[model samples]
Target chain A: MEGTNFQRYLARKKAMSAYTWNEVKKHKMLYLFLFPFLLIFATFTLAPVGISLGLSFTYFNVLEPPRWIGFTNYLNLFLSDDIFIIALRNTIILATITGPVGFMAAFLFAWFINELPRFIRAFVTLVFYAPTIAGSAYLVWLLIFSGDSMGHLNAYLMRAGIINSPILWLTNPDYMMYVIIIVVLWMSLGAGFLAFIAGLSTIDEALYEAGLVDGVRNRWQELWFITLPNMQGMLLFGAVMAITSSFAVGEVTQNLAGFPSTDYEVHTIVNHLVDYGAMRFEMGYASAIATILFISMIYAKRIVSSFIGKIGR
Target chain B: MIGAAKKDKTSASGRRIVKVSRAVRKPNRSLGGDIFIWGILIIFGIFFIFPLVFNINQAFKPLNEIFIFPPNLFVINPTTDNISDLFIIMSRSWVTFTRYIFNTVFITFVGTAGHLFVASLGAFAVSKYDFPGSKFFFGIIITALMFNQYVTAIPNFLILTQLGWIDTYWAVIIPAFGMPLGFFLMKQFMDTIPVSLVEAAKIDGASEWLIYWRIVLPLVKPALLTVMVFAVQALWNNPQSLVIHTEQLKTLPLAISQIIGSPHAPQVARAGVNAAGLMVLMMVPIIIFVTAQSNILKTMASSGIKE
Candidate 1:
């Protein structure tokens, strides 16, 4: 029995090696086609990630040799960095506000479109979605909050006698987070809205018919039992997108709030890392922050996926 | 079916009577829904268009008029003075306003074209070829999609620096070629194509290249256009990457930033510049989107892909 088992093991190894070689030979052309892309992707995407992971454990300042520090950067970031904490807080705030609002807005817009006559629905969707292509959503907000007497929002406020003095909306730290959140909602509304619209379009019309037959009356009932359940995948997808976007909240903050808000109130984890990682060249510390952010995103993703799976099932 | 038809007919006549009575009682309700839709649409339209309109208005207005009380919605005398001044400030030897435009156009075109080629080929491989590691390749693509650029900015910068690629168009165009989102969208669309066609092509002894070019390429036009729209928008709106390599090469967003950050940066007129820059940057994408709007939406809706 022992001799036969050894022979079986040897036979299995030979078969596996042959299978591997056969796969290599059969797909040789495909590999050739994929070579350039794989090369570039490795250099650009995979290699950087691997390097960053390594650098997270080392103390490197771009100019000096990378010294092996072994989790010191991570420890220091958690223990001593006040800015990182502030960044984490701000990012959470922005994400928390933007995610739900944006998701709801998109879902509603999509549902509204889906309910409309087919041709008109397409036209309205195109128009509603045009702002996304226009790339001036943030610019519109800038016009509204120009921080001066001639600014549109301030001008309207003054005319209405709401306030005697123009409010420094962008400059003031108190309102900066709100301003960023509003802009993010505006910009993100288009994409997520479109996603939800797409998701709504996929809900088997038969499901709605079934709901109607079962006496699922009114918008709320239809939404809870029919729409929401059918759109589970999309909701999960949108949530992941929102979370990732929240983590990477740099552009609106940088553009509208400007760098280092009054007391760093508007700074996010991304902004902090960008300042240190790119500007100041603190490679080790920046990598640590990035790794933490990445891990959090993965955790969020798992939770979202599980939630989607439960709903889908 | 007959009972439902009878019920529909009864409901229609009953609704007609109610509609007549209701119209008599509340005339406005007849137009109320239409009015409400139009009102909402107009308000949102204005909200959407105001920045571009305001900026265009500001760009043409005299610098003094830019800050006029109750800021002019309509510029009385639209002039090129600000634009000419902008040109003068932006011009340095061969690098002029026209040069900036040229640089932006060139980068956008090259970047979009590169993305189309590489992403399509990669997508075709992943979708059609039952090769070993195809799944692994696709997994990598999806993983890359989730890997936020913000997190990878440091490592990407380090790699670029090591390669001495900073300040070069390659720094922008090369990396953008393998857009994972574009690849994924294309793959999803390509998956719907009948595999029998590819097999038939193989039976004819056609090379993989010919099969892709002749069969897969034509079949995936809509997806290609979708990818094009995405690529153009991404490259055009990318401001951060431009910041990394800021020396000789300047894209539209970066150019606008330079104007904003310049010594003569008009405090109030900055709003106008912001608007004008965004408007100009947005024009190309809007035009492309309008031309391919139907195909784009159909592909998006049917394929269930999002950026």
Candidate 2:
């Protein structure tokens, strides 16, 4: 009986290989079409990621040969690094706030815009999308929050007697996180938003007509019965984008508040990684931070997907 | 079975002309609702619109007007001095200003085109085919989509150096081709295309490549253009100082940053020059976006809440 079972297993394995070979033979043209992308993806993307993962456990600082030290970097990062803790805490706060807010805002605004005439809809889309496409335009936010009395917000507020003096908006740790969150949301005009707009447009109008016939009387009911269910895929796409972007809030914070903010209050996990990776030349530790971030994000996406699945059920 | 779904799909979900007419006819249908929606839009518009307005105003202001106690919102008199001064300041650089434009345009065009074609093909394979590793490749891209793009920069830099791509255009454009967002997006959009459409093509002896190129590509043009807009936006704004090292290879952002942030410029260090540079950095991309705005906006129709 054991010999027969072993033989059966071997035969199954052989069948699988033969089937796979046949698949390759049949899809040769498709494989040829896919070849260039897979080559670049493997060489540039996959290989580097794999190498970075390996380097995470080492002590290489670019000059020296890598010395494997197991999980020392990870241990230090979690157990002892105070700045890392602050960054981690701030990142979670940012992700929780901006992720949901941006995701919902994208869908809601796109849905609203879809109600307009085509020409006006296009104009409105460009207007809303201006913030994202306008690179470094968020620097205007710095001018708004500038410490000088000449700053726009300060001047207006002072004229209205809203404050005694110009506040150190970018510097003061108390206002740093709030200001960063606001700027982030302002610039949250992203690919996902455009994708949502496009997604909303592509939604078949007949679905709404059928829903109206099916007793979907008001816009709200129409939205629920017709729109949301249809946009389920795009919703998932938006969520994935939102999660990645919200977690990657370091760029905006570093640019606005200045990297290594006063009291390090505005620091994020990506900033912490940058502080190690770019500034300190500790590639291993930086890779470790990246690995943790990558894993955490993947897990976050899983939770988001599972939670999204439960909605509208 | 596929034929039945195809017939039903055309009858039930084919473009609804009546629904569009009803929406257009109902313009004054809800005054209060319009006010609410427009109210929200106006507020968000202020947030989104301020940057473009501010840049234009700042560029035209004389030095005195810029630092005045109560800042003016719009320019009273627009001048060409800033533009002229920026060109003069830029003359001091090692490379010509046109070289910078050429480099930027080169990278943006090549990067955008490469990304659209390659990413869509990758997406097409995963969406339309089933092979041993198709599921795995799809899973890989999804997993890739989960992480921040900036995470592997150091490793990428090291690999590029090893490939002798550190100072070349390939260093910039190659990695962009691997950006996973377009792949994810194209796949999502392709998933919306009726499988029966592809089957109809297949029944006519259409090869897989032909089916994808002709039948699938045209159907997903909006998504293609949307992805193109995204790729263009990224490559256009990409800083020269970040990727390439050569002075001649410096993209627009790097050149602008250098002049704007230059500590020891006599005339160019002024805020006017900075404003001029900002406008320059901004206008080209804005013009391109405005030109291609229709194509980009086409994605809006197909990308939204689907049935």
The candidate that achieves the highest lDDT relative to the unseen native structure: 2
Q: How accurate is candidate 2 locally (lDDT)?
A: 0.78
Tens-digit per-residue lDDT, A1-313, candidate 2: 9999999999999999999999989888777777778888777778877888998999989999889999999999999999999999999999999999988888778877876666688778878877777777666676678767887888989988999898889888879889999888877757678767876777776777677666553455566667777767667777888888898888788877887788989899999888888899999999998888888888888888787666666
- Candidate 2 lDDT for residue B8: 40
TM-score per model over all chains: 0.85, 0.89
- Which tens-of-lDDT digit does each residue in B1-307 have in candidate 1? 2323343444455556434665353211223343444556557656555655566676677767776788667788887777566555567535566766777888888988988888888788888988778987887776576677877777888788788888877788888886677877788788879999999999999998998899999988988888888888888767655335554577766776566553223455454554444555666666787787766755555444222
| The best candidate in terms of DockQ | 2
- Please tell me how candidate 1 rates in CAPRI terms: acceptable
lDDT of 2 by residue, B167-237 (tens): 89999898888777778778767877899998888899998889888889989987787788778777777
Residue A265, candidate 1: how far off, in angstroms? 1.1
Error of model 2, residue A242, in angstroms: 0.9
lDDT for model 1 comes to 0.71
lDDT of 1 by residue, A1-313 (tens): 9999999999999999899889879878778877777777787778777888889999989899899999899888878998889988887787677766766666766765665556787667766666666664455566678788877788989999999999889888878888887667656654455567766777786876677568653344566777787666457656666666666778678767777777888998888888888688888988888888888777766775675566523
Complex DockQ, candidate 1: 0.32
